[model samples]
Target: MVRIKRWLLAALVMSAGVSGFMLTKGTSHAATTDPQTFISTLKSPVTTVANQYKLYPSVMMAQAALESAWGTSTLTTTANNYFGIKGSYNGASVTMKTAEYDSNGQLYYTNANFRKYPSAKASMTDNAKLLRNGTSYNTSIYSGTWRENAATYADAANALTGTYATAPTYGSSLISIIKQYGLNTLLDASASDSSSSNSNSGSTPKPKPVVYSKATYYGASGTQTARLSGQYATYRLYNHVKGTRANITKTAWSKVAAGKNVLVYLDMRGVKKDASTGKKTTWYRIRFAKNTSAKKYWVYTKALTLPTVKYTSGTAAVKVNNTVSGSYYDHVFNSPYLAKSMGALNKLTAKSYVADKQAIKTQDGYKSTWYRIKVGKQAYWIAATETAAAPQYDAVTYSAASGTKKLSAKYSKYTLYNHVKKTHFNQKTYKWPAGSKKGTKVTVNFKGVKTAYKTTWYRIQFNGSQTNYWVDARALA
Candidate 1:
């Protein structure tokens, strides 16, 4: 049985305003006949006011459109009051007939005094101040401190509908208008422009895209329906989050071939333990191609190779070695107290690259460190302890200048530690081969320093031997 989560109920309630206002019937004005023209003319002023108030311009424009009827209302044309702000401003006022709903939901017609602004810009600015600071007519809906609350456009619209408007659908109506015209895109574009301007002015650059691990699933490719059995044998596909399972029948299953790409939608849910292996692993809800009947599924986190870095726009370029060990996700949870297991790492490809590293706090309050790596375009996380810095020796050209240092004279002999291969810095010490003897007359091939260990190791080739070995400088005389 899959569990469903209720995360969107609060947003629905806030969108459905309980009370609403009715617009008074009036003749349209010829000066602002086109809705598009009216909206375009006011966009600049509306955005200015919204930015000053930390409110969404889309919400403000929608409210103005509703209250002024696209600038055709007599009150808007004559008094430049697009927001129906009622009060004396600079001692200028206009008496207008409007409809209001009483406490018992009864509609009543009444003549009220409205503020007269010098221009539409002034009217829009004053409207923002009214909502942000509040007046004798209503308390501040956004916040007592200016521009501190109302983090989103929907939040500002909801607050106005709940406290500033008398109509039940006022908030939803504003949202509809904003969405119908795709006004949020303009808001986003404006923000991007601001970020660019800030960068040109020598300010701190905008945040770069955070790199994460990319994962893949290796399952058989075919359309075979198989019922999941056993305790925790069933992999539930969630609509979103942990508890919201998809409505599709549990008996339906589609398997893809090993190394097939699965696009990951969300990775922040933390780790789940694999019941069969008793291994702590992270699960990714992945999206498959349209051709696949099962468009989405949850797979074991270990079946994919995580990259070392995920690059984002505005991030500084970092040079990284492309080689990594096969062991991934051994103890990479955001918590350290959890027991470590190699089952997850054993499922991934033998080698990958490290893209980035970060310290994270897991749900259980353990400080687990992780590394961000990429396998193709996808990102995944792995335990920091499982990987070591492997520099590309093939990319480095060996020359006399690079190997000027000779073997130390303190000791005359050195034992071979594994077959001569590329030296690894900052890694665990290699064990000496059994029955190996130390010799003093080895020819030094290269002298290099491992930055991670802060030590020097000599790459040496013994007389008439094709193999080379890396011996610590401390071990040679």
Candidate 2:
């Protein structure tokens, strides 16, 4: 009877201790065998959380991998609890068996309560909060791991050893995993965070370039030209990351590519080269208007196709077509090349200016056309709205003009007009930055007004030039 009572008492004590860590089974979030996919899954959120909390993402990332065994651990797979954090999360908890050290420094396994997170982001957020805010007893306990506090990620890792986990080698384990997996490449080049190396501290983590996402979005120094192949859904980039799905229709650059030949204004976003194979991908941002104040979209330079511009021998002429058109840098290029435009040559010089060459192709719906020309030794491509001999404008059509206004702004465009059709031929070009008369209010002499369709078109000529331009009568006031 004594032995029986003693055995029962021992069982009761075990049950009470085990109660702290319930061993009930729970559902998993996601499971994957591919290490790359697993890393990709947590990288963005971890980096974001690190950036937000001012912690070394490298150390944090290493901890996650070491703790979750590359996201295969039951805590991670079942509860998305990558850090094995104790207690309930948002009132949700999971019971799981975990390894713990005993009073004699012996390792033992027992069930313990762990936080159950809704997603990897939630788990990451909770971990970041702990590292940043520390525990209830000590708020700055993990401050040594912060980018501001530690000079390098190793220091941060070392700081976490006994504090973050009971293991004395936790820091070295994190450092080893970080090196083995190459998680330090982009430590200084986080999606939107300022470079960590900017601080004088040697503790800033060196980079192994954790590719958090498949898309490699980067900033560029200049502009290029490209076209949208089709309607691409747009999103507002948060943290410099493509985030927050927005209603595409609400933006002005919305639904722009509707099987139309309308050209897009583009800026070269830059070319990204793969570090492994040296393969390159050129990218650009699209704008609907010439102004920089408008929103822009991203596009692959490869998709902005321009059929080989086959030039024929012999000079051609452009007659007044009374519609606006565009011209490109003889070829679409990645700079040391520019994608700017200028108002085409004046009507008088059209013939000789195009003397260099003339050729046409099956243009989709080019509005108006021009070819390579030269002024002195400098080569340029100019356009005029006369009759284009070889080019055809077949894809889209424009409606008759309406609501004529003589409105002008500080950055007035140097627009060209066709006398025959009394319509807009082309606008002032971006004349390669300086030496432009875009906003000069040339003195005008009014010819007369032709009222039709509830609007009036007024014919006028600038004081010094014989070219007659029709402005809406309302333009004078």
Best of the candidates, lDDT: 2
Q: Give one digit per residue, the lDDT tens place, for model 1 in 138-174.
A: 3433341222344455655665543565354667888
Deviation in angstroms for 118 in model 2? Answer: 0.4
Error of 2 at 371 (Å): 99
Q: List the candidates' TM-scores in order.
A: 0.35, 0.35
Residue ranges of candidate 1 with Cα displaced over 4 Å:
1-33, 101-105, 136-140, 144-148, 199-477
Report the C-alpha lDDT of model 2 over 1-477, residue by residue, as the tens digit: 000100111111222122121222453233454555656666787788888787777777787776665665566666787777778887888886655567455867677677878787788788888888777865665666766656667777877754676455678888997787777765424722355456666354454432222334443323443344443322211122121121111222334542334466655454555433455655556666666665666554544543334444433333323233444343322232334544432332333332355434333545444455454466555443344222322222223432323334422333333331222223212221233243434344443333233444344444355655644434443
Report residue 300 deviation for candidate 1 (angstroms): 49
Q: What is the lDDT of residue 172 in candidate 1?
A: 83
